[model samples]
Target: MSFLLTSCSTYPVEVTSADQLAGVWEDFAGRTVEFKGDGTFTATGMDEADVGEECSGVAATQQGALSLSGTYADVTFDGVDCEGMMLAFYGSPSSFVVCFTRDVTAGGCTGELSRKDDVTATGRHE
Candidate 1:
């Protein structure tokens, strides 16, 4: 005789409002994204000398706006800003992520939204 066991984990916390998104998130390249409560955001810690299609870090330095669409938020830059920038939070409010994709139609773009550390927020960093 044998027994079978299974385990499940809670899905990452979905960002629903600007209040939930208001905080600082640092990417793998040491770039930081500061999301403000007033539908405004600022990103820093990127060098203009190194920018390209593959490197989305440049978007971090550009001023952008956020509009929540369901559980995901779309980030559009000003002027000729970064194309296809999206924001999503997982695991917890402390876990922030950003993705660069025009759309995830078909089977969905996997492994794009990476986890980032939440540096600060108004009062929702727990």
Candidate 2:
């Protein structure tokens, strides 16, 4: 008898607009990034070693815990325009959305990759 084996690899989707990435993604270590629909984003525990630092992009708001309000710039795969953060969002079929670590001098993302199922929205319109 003879047997054959094959493997298939899946690739993550390159997120272009903020609408597609509007959600909260968490990694295995609880690291998370919330891509608000209002063109803003919030990142928590971005460090691999568990840092209790929370960063909110664009405007700050009291809407609630982990929320952003007011008009803000668009966040794309290229980078974020606020807080000197460089976050890159992507889509994955296996999970939901994802954020990958970048190679930059400024805040070019942290952790390896984060993915979650929950979603929260605001604006993110042109």
Highest lDDT: which candidate? 1
Would you list the C-alpha lDDT of every candidate in the order shown? 0.49, 0.36
lDDT score at residue 64, model 1, on the 0-100 scale: 70
Model 2 per-residue lDDT tens digits across residues 15-94? 44456557776654555667676555566654322221233322222122212111112222223232322343333433
lDDT of 2 at 21: 52
Give residue 112's lDDT in candidate 2 (0 to 100). 32
- Overlapping backbone residue pairs in candidate 2 total 3
Off by over 4 Å in 2: 1-12, 48-85, 89-97, 103-110, 118-126
Model 1 scores a TM of 0.55
Which segments of model 1 are wrong by more than 4 Å? 1-12, 46-61, 81-84, 92-96, 103-126
Highest TM-score among the candidates is held by which one? 1
Clashes of each: 1, 3
